[model samples]
Target: WDAAYERELQTFEDIGDTGEIWFGEESMVRIIRWLERHKVPLDSSVLDIGTGNGVLLVELAKSGYMNLTGIDYSPSAIQLSERVREKEGMSNIKLKVEDFLAPSAELSGFDICIDKGTLDAISLDPDDAVGKRKQYVRSLSSVLKPEGFFLITSCNWTKEELLSEFGEGFEILEELPTPKFCFGGRIGNSVTALVFQRKKAKPSILDKLD
Candidate 1:
C-alpha cells in the first residue's frame, strides 16, 4: 500500500475520546473468565489478529502466556505496541504491522487465534466486505492448527450475525452477549463473544491452491 493509503488506517493517534478508551471492558472481562474456565495449556501459541492498542494481548501476557503474536495494519499502532511492550518489559509477545488478509510467514502455526473487533470493522466496509471476509477467513484457516480456537469479540454484531458468516466450517463452542445495562430504560447488547474451534487441519499450499 502507498503512504497515502496507509495514512487512512485507524490508529491510536486517530482514536478520539482517549479518556473513554480502556482495556478492561466488561465483555473482555467475561472473555477472560471464559478462557480461565476452559484453561488451555500455557504452552499454546496465540495469534492476535488486528490487535488494537495491544491491550488484549497484554492481558494475555499478564495471564502468563508466553507465545503471543499480534498483527495489525496500522504503522502507528505497531510503533505504539512496540513501545508498550518494551516499557512493560514484555519479551514474548511479538507485534507486526500487517494486513489481516495477508499472512506473514511468522504468523502461521498458531494454536489459538483471537480477534477483537477486527472482522467486524472489515464487514462494515461495503466495497471490500465479501472479498475481505473470504481472504481473512482463508488466511485464518491456513494459520490455525487443527483443534485450534478462534475467539472473537464484537460489539457491532450479534451472535447470529457471526454464525451466519462462519458456522459451517467450524464448531461454535459458545455464543453469548454482554450484559445489558439500563440507564433510562433503553438497553442493548453491549457486545457479542464467540469462540469456534477450527476442525480441519491447516491445508498445504497445494490444498489451498486446489
Candidate 2:
C-alpha cells in the first residue's frame, strides 16, 4: 500500500487499477443510506479503516457527518489521504497513519467503523494469516463502543463467511444489496455488504453475585 500510494494515485481505484472491486464511491452511498435507515446520528463518530485515498471520509463529511476519522497503516497512504482531504477542503475529517490490527489508544470508542476491502487485504498476508485476522477482530472490538455498528464490504468473503468471522462479539443487523451477476444460470452477488452491531457484554457470575 505504501508503494502503491507512492505512485500518487488520485483515488483508491487508481492505486492498483482495481476500479471494478474498489467501488469506494458506490460503497459510500450505500453506507450512508444504511446509516440513515438505521438512524445513526450525523454527529456520531465514524472511523474508516484502511482509508487509502480517504474519498469515503470526504463523502461522509459532505453528507453531514461531523465526526469522521480515517486510518491507514501506510504513511504514504495517509499522506495521499491527507492530500485528498485537504484538496476537498475537508480539514475536519481526521486522517491518521495507524494500523487497524494494532490501533492507537485514540482510535477507540467510535460509534461506527467502516471497512472496505481492508480485511480482505489483511487476510492475504502470507505469514500467519489466521493470527492476523484474529488480531484484526480483537482490535476492531476494542475500538468500538458497546452496540456500535460495523459496516463492512468485501468481494473476497461471502456473507456467510463474514457472519461467521464476526459472530463471536457481533450480531447481524442487516445485509445491503450489492450488484449481482449470473454464471452458469445461477445469480450471485459480486460483493458482500454486511452491517453488524457489537454485542453488549453480559454480566459475569462474579458481577451478578456482587
Candidate 3:
C-alpha cells in the first residue's frame, strides 16, 4: 500500500482523540449485536486479516475478548497497531506484520476470521481479482476450524455477490447491508456484510454430478 493510503487507514490514529475515522461506538454496537445474533462470545478466537493499525482488534479486545490477533502487510500499519495495543494496555491482542496473501505457517486456528477493507483492496485489480480471491478463501479455510465463521465487510460487493463466490463450502447465516448512519462521510454507499459458517458435511449428491 502507498504511504497516502496508509495515512488514510490510520486517519483515526487518535484512538478516540477527536472526530476521527476509527470504528465508533455506534458501529461497534451494531457489530456486537450481530455477534450476539451469531453467538460469538469472549471464548471465540478471532483473526483480523488486513488489520491495518488493528483498530477492530483493539475494539474486540475492549469487549472482553482476549483471543484476538491481527495481521497486515504494511509495516507502518503494524507499528502503529502495536503502539495502540501498548497504549491501551491490551496484552492479549497479537498484532503481526505479514502479507496475508503469501503462504505462511504463522496463520491458523481461529474461530472467526474477519476482513474489513482487505477484500476490497484486492478486488480493485481485475486481472488479479479471481486469483487473489481464491487465495484468500483457501487460506481462511485453512486457518479457521471446521464450522468457523468468516465475517467480511466490503463496499465493493453486494451480500448476494459474496455468497455466490464464497458459498460453496460455507453456510450463510447473516448477509446484509450496513446501516448508513454509523459511518463517516456521506455514508450513502452500500456495504456488504456477511457471516458464514464453514460447512463440515460432504458435498452430498452435488459432488457426484460434477
Evaluated with lDDT, which candidate comes out highest?
2
Comparing 1 with 2 on TM-score, the higher-scoring candidate is: 2
TM-score between model 3 and native? 0.80
**In candidate 1, what are the lDDT values of residues 1-210, reduced to their tens digit?**
224223433333475211112324664566566778788777789888876566677777888788888888877666666655765678788988888788777678889898888887788987979899888788888889877898888877788878777765678988755676676788766777899988875679999899
lDDT of 2 by residue, 51-154 (tens): 88788888889989999999999998888777777778999999888978888888899999999999999999999999999999999899999999999999
lDDT of 1 at 178: 62
Best model number under TM-score:
2
Q: What are the clashing pairs of model 2?
A: none
- TM-score, candidate number 1: 0.79
Worst lDDT 10-window in candidate 3: 15-24
RMSD values, in order shown: 5.4, 3.0, 5.3
lDDT of each: 0.74, 0.87, 0.74
Where does candidate 2 stray beyond 4 Å? 9-21
TM-score of each: 0.79, 0.92, 0.80
lDDT of 2 at 85: 79
